[model samples]
Target: MSYFGGQPTNPFGAPTPKPPILKRQVPPLPENLDMATLADIRCSVNIFSPATGEIIEVVVGVEKRKFHVHDQILRSGSAFFKTALSKEWKEGKTRVVLLPDDAASLVDRYVQWLYTGKVGVTLDNGKTDYATLAGLYCLGEKLMHDAFQDRIVDALVSGTREPNNNAGHPTTCSFPMKDVVDDIYKGTPKGSPARRFMVDMHVMQGTSGWIDVERPESVNHEFAVDLAFAMMQERAVTGETKTKHAELNRGIPCSYHKHGKDGVCGGKA
Candidate 1:
């Protein structure tokens, strides 16, 4: 009997041939490769050589606090720098980038992220500095640094996950207050990751008393409208009762990420 019913007649004519399986061949390693040399090559390709690269002065804020940064590092990390430092621009000729509108502290944080790949957002009181992180996100957006914005999102998410110690009261992670929300809304456009994050945080963790007392008049009209729509959507999916903060916390991190594509979180792989 053939594999298919009533099809046994063709079996004697010719056996069907199977397709060949192709294997991918990787190049062989060098016979006498030096590990130290290989390591050095990798480092040279990955790390910016501040010593060899030309230094550029970034004049930040109204006071024009000068921050000396490596041009190579700036161009490599930020699209704004890449364009501004190109041959056509005056900034390229002078090697001095002025950012008069941005805060000096935020620009300093950007410089720090360029070198260290880390963002510092913790305050002395053990609370996360949402205000600074929000500002950094805006700065990253202005600078066209997608990776930096993603990093700031990661910091925001991580900050909210940690137990915040407020005085001697019970530990609870509070979302960013009114001023931070206003700043983010003003700086970013609609459908921004930070805005979505704020909406999600409030919808998941917020109580009526918290809104009425803790953040009275903090939520602006735009934010309130977005929150209302998001809440309706959430209710449609999960039913009328508020979704637990634990369930919301258990959601995927990528949902809060700001990368261009869906399901793809940028910055770290």
Candidate 2:
């Protein structure tokens, strides 16, 4: 039967969307009254090397250190844990997983992000940050952390596309140092989005020739091959060619120095 004008209401039957869970509760709930499902809880897990009993191992040159981490947080966001922590696996039985090859600091940040959804990488001037992001992206790919991978990609793109970063034209921006680019190409797979984006950035900056001539020694051979292939594909489909008369503006800082003080080279004068 119609309630008011002739239309019936179904407020009780209509599904209501649930609100997102807040990271922290505001004003705190009363301690005396408690709900089993609404309380903050901690479940600890061991992530250790089988022999060392260390959660995370970091190696620098010849020195190594270990870390301790929680289980719920690590398991929440990483697919690598799904199988690694399964009942049949030895890691599941012992509550430990070995990561001897990974950098400790990067793994630390990844664990923190698993808990807080925030990566603690600093981007003060954006110079070293690219390498950090590239490394994190590689780690994310290795760990099958899709969300973290996307986050790193967003950071990389935004840093390069910063308003003052355009040099002169909006279509142009900065690139990473030779070492950082090399690390990215070396760790990432061919046709990775991050790698492809970097290639596209070099091309879009009208710096395709810049890659060929200016400091070609700095470029990695494999990366150069990938860039060439990407450029060829870009040309074949769009018929766009590299700019023959592109200017090499010495006024702007190179990829290594733009993140330095006053946008100067960080390593050299």
Candidate 3:
């Protein structure tokens, strides 16, 4: 259901926009990643952003996240909801509330973010926390639930976010693709347009790309594979089946985004 009144519930799923995953040529590797042993990086969760009143089903990998543990991470992808909404994680000696809902089957993507600080998704999952929060800040961004979306945005923006990287591009297109992917996998609606103010910090690292992509995914696994390829591709040394390279730029082509994507990729603020 559209929680944003007339906005597309799942924009990425439709039309399946052409991804910016290019190498000055069409790639012939993405389709065969199935042989790469799709490692499971998902986690079942019930997340309540007290900030936005959003109750979410989080998919996380095996990472030690102190965000708001509603469930225990015994293994990977094996978890239970926190019973109720009051199971806010505390310091010590706090009671972890239990839930009575059947919120299972949400995993992998979230775990990707926990381990690598990034996530990605298709129509079959929930949006990662970071990307979902970014969408909320832009407002009008498509979302599974308005209140919940707002809460996630509120949490990250509410705090002091330390500099993660120098070339951290936060726009929908150049957006931490992996993070947005995580959110999409978890079923978070892509965002509408973003405001200049919001785009400045997140999109452009406090600079621009406010409106263009509602929910941005690389259109294919090429984005991620290409990225990983970039680092290792050149280092494969004699093509010994190890290391590759990636080709990522700020050209995913997303408009209709609110603030007009006023920044450059890699957060050029």
Candidate 4:
């Protein structure tokens, strides 16, 4: 229950999504912080470091949870875009330490596991727990790499739009739907990078199962396929041409296209 203008109302209004409170292993600590750190985090850079070199290095400190770590320096070997983005504003090419707080949260999740040698993510009680869950999702993605993040995102976004269902995304998948939806609605438009960054959807499993990092290969593929298939099916069902997919299952065509050459239509037309 959240107090909106002094009135207690459902955090998730009509949809009544699974609450972040329910997922909490520890109740909201007024500001329960789970800190993280990254050290020598090196990723590949184009034309900056021999087509691959040091991208960022960071060390995080969380006053609570006794979580502290100095990760093995990170380095990338041949990559284009860099996600280790920073606002420090250096000359030409520079290292990015400490991702934004929200992004760093993910790094903490990974380091915490490596340090304690323990999987901290567990559904301890029947409260909508966002903090712990969010941390776990971030950690899992960080450690496991893009596959993990992609899997989680696909699962979370399943049924969120047309592509999800077409890809065989299951309804049982757990990804923070409510929080993400709230974040999207509450966040500023695309222009507002700050607000966009603040809107982290690492937690929101809606009417889905628990957000566990088990079986990534199966889960992600199934979800992606479901999303793709569902999207194609939706297009056909709606008699939409030229455009192979629709947005949000609302029969609205997207201006752009993606995926392999086949994509939504699969060149059947």
Q: Top model by TM-score, which number? A: 1
lDDT of 2 by residue, 77-99 (tens): 45776567777988777776777
Output the lDDT of residue 125, model 3.
27
Q: Name model 1 segments beyond 4 Å from true.
A: 1-52, 167-171, 210-218, 236-269
**What is candidate 4's lDDT per residue for 126-187, written digit by digit as tens?**
22333444444454433333323333333333323322232365343333433433343332
Model 4 has an lDDT value of 0.31
**How would you encode candidate 1's per-residue C-alpha lDDT over 1-269 as one tens digit per residue?**
00000100111233223223334422222222234533433422222223225778888889998887766667765778889999899999999999999998888767655543444477767678889888988997898776677778877787777776674545777678777888889889899988999999889887775454465466577888998898888874444333544445566555446674455556447
User: All candidates' TM-scores?
Assistant: 0.66, 0.58, 0.21, 0.28
Clash pairs, candidate 2, are: 47-55
User: What is candidate 3's lDDT per residue for 1-269, written digit by digit as tens?
Assistant: 00111111122233212234324442221121222223332312212111122323332224422223222221111222222223454411243322222121222223223222222322232222445444433321221233323333444443224333333543322234444533333342223222222323342341224323455453334333433444454443443322221121234333333446574445333
lDDT-based ranking = 1, 2, 4, 3
Q: How much lDDT does each candidate structure score?
A: 0.67, 0.54, 0.30, 0.31
- TM-score of decoy 4: 0.28
For all candidates, what are the clash counts?
0, 1, 62, 48
Comparing 1 and 4 on TM-score, the stronger one: 1
Error of 2 at 33 (Å): 30
Cα lDDT, model 1, residue 77: 54
The lowest-lDDT stretch of 10 consecutive residues in candidate 1 is 1-10
